[model samples]
Target: MEIKGENISFRYNIDSDWILKDVNIFLKTNQIIGLMGSSGSGKSTLCKILTGYINNYEGDVYLDGEKVNNNGFNPIQLVFQHPEKTINPKWKMNKALNESWNPPKELLDKFGIQQSWLNRWPNELSGGELQRFAVIRALSPKTKFLIADEMTTMLDAVTQVQIWQNVINIAKERKIGVLVVSHDKKLLNRLCDETIHLNIPFKIFFI
Candidate 1:
């Protein structure tokens, strides 16, 4: 399976400058690709566009040659930098997780989610714990591709390694394509099969 973004362009509004313009990207299920760019280069915006979060973009996002459908459960899932923003404050952690899909106990363990944390509200747990849930939530069986937008930026070094290891393992096992967007070149180098740089000119180069 593959996710392809063709002639993609976007801006905040008519008055604003284009953050992304005529950008094209492609990812295959067997590859773990990294996307890097300077601030304001629209890496996050492109991630949103690819995952159907930003529907007003100028071009098309296709999955296996068909236009992506955003109506129901999205095959392309995104795990954001701030996990707290993604979860509901009123719902318990378990509900937030189960809202996507019920993952197995072993999967939960691999992500370092404690059984007790599931019973607590989003506010009750630390950011790292909440992020663990967020990552797991995006790993539903129905997910065909995952866009990690600075997914581990807030976590400590140890936690970052742990989470990425688990996510990569599961993604490989399920043949899910992964797009990792990050500013840290070293982390990208360590995790990605190939890295694509999104420069100020909106040009993409594979390294």
Candidate 2:
């Protein structure tokens, strides 16, 4: 399976400058793609467009040659930099996680999520712990493509490596495509099969 964005372009409003323009990208199952850009280059915006979060853009996003349907469970999932923003304050961690899909106990263990932590509110857990849940939640069986938008920027080095390792293992096992958007060139180099740099309005060149 593949997710393809064609002739994509977007701006905040009529008065604003285009953040992304005529940008194209592709990701296939079992492949890891890295997207790099400086600040204000619209890397995150493109991720949102690909995942159907922002639909007002000028071009189209397709999955396996068909236009993506935003209704129902989205095949494309996005994990944001701030996990807390994605979780509901009123819901406990377990409820938040189960909303996507109930992952196996071993899967939870691999992400280092403690059984006790599931009972706590999002506010009670540290960012790293909450991020673990966020990552696991996005790994639902229905998910075909995952766009990680600076997903581990806040974690310590050890924790970041641990989460990425587990995620990569599961992604490979399930033949899921992954788009990792990050500023860390080293991390991208370590994880991605191919890397693309996004220039303003954007020109994408594979390396």
Candidate 3:
């Protein structure tokens, strides 16, 4: 399966400036693509468009040649840079993690999630711990494509490596396509099969 964004363009409002223009991107089930651009570039906006977050945009997004369905379980799952924003404050970690699928104990063990942390609220666990749960939740069996929008920005170096290790393993096991949006070139080079640079009124090119 593959996700394709063809001629994507966007702006905030009628009078606002355009955030992206004529942007084209594609992700295949067996590939890990890196999206990189300067500050204020529409990398995140494009991710939102691909994952059905922002609807008022130009052009089409197709998942394996079919248009994406906004309603119900989305095959394209997004894990944002901030875990705090990704998770619900009211729900406990256990409830949040198991919302879509019951993750295996081994996955939790690999993420280094303590059994005790599951009972605590999102605010109770540290940032790193909460992010582990968030990433795990995003890796449900139903997820065909996973979008990591700076997903590991908050964790320490060690924690970041640990999380990415688990994510890469899961992606390989499921043959899931991954869109890794990050400003860290080193991290991008380490994981991505190839990289694309997005410019204003964007033109995508290999970097």
Choose the strongest candidate by lDDT.
2
Q: TM-score of predicted model 2?
A: 0.95
Clashing pairs in 2: none
As a whole number from 0 to 100, the lDDT of residue 170 in candidate 1 is 89
* Candidate 1 per-residue C-alpha lDDT over 23-61 given as tens digits, one digit per residue, 9 for 90 to 100: 888888868999988988998898888888888989888
Off by over 4 Å in 1: 204-207
The pairs that clash in candidate 1 are none
* lDDT against the true structure, each candidate: 0.88, 0.89, 0.87
Once superposed on the true structure, which residue ranges of model 2 sit more than 4 Å away at CA? 204-207
lDDT of 1: 0.88
lDDT of 2 at 71: 87
Pick by TM-score: 2 or 3, better one: 2
User: Which of the predicted structures, 2 or 3, would earn the higher lDDT when compared with the native?
Assistant: 2
| lDDT per residue (tens digit) for residues 35-130 in model 2 | 999988998898888888898999888999988867888889999878899899999998999996999999899988999998999999998899
TM-score of 1: 0.95
Q: After superposition, how far is residue 183 of candidate 1 from its true place, in Å?
A: 1.2
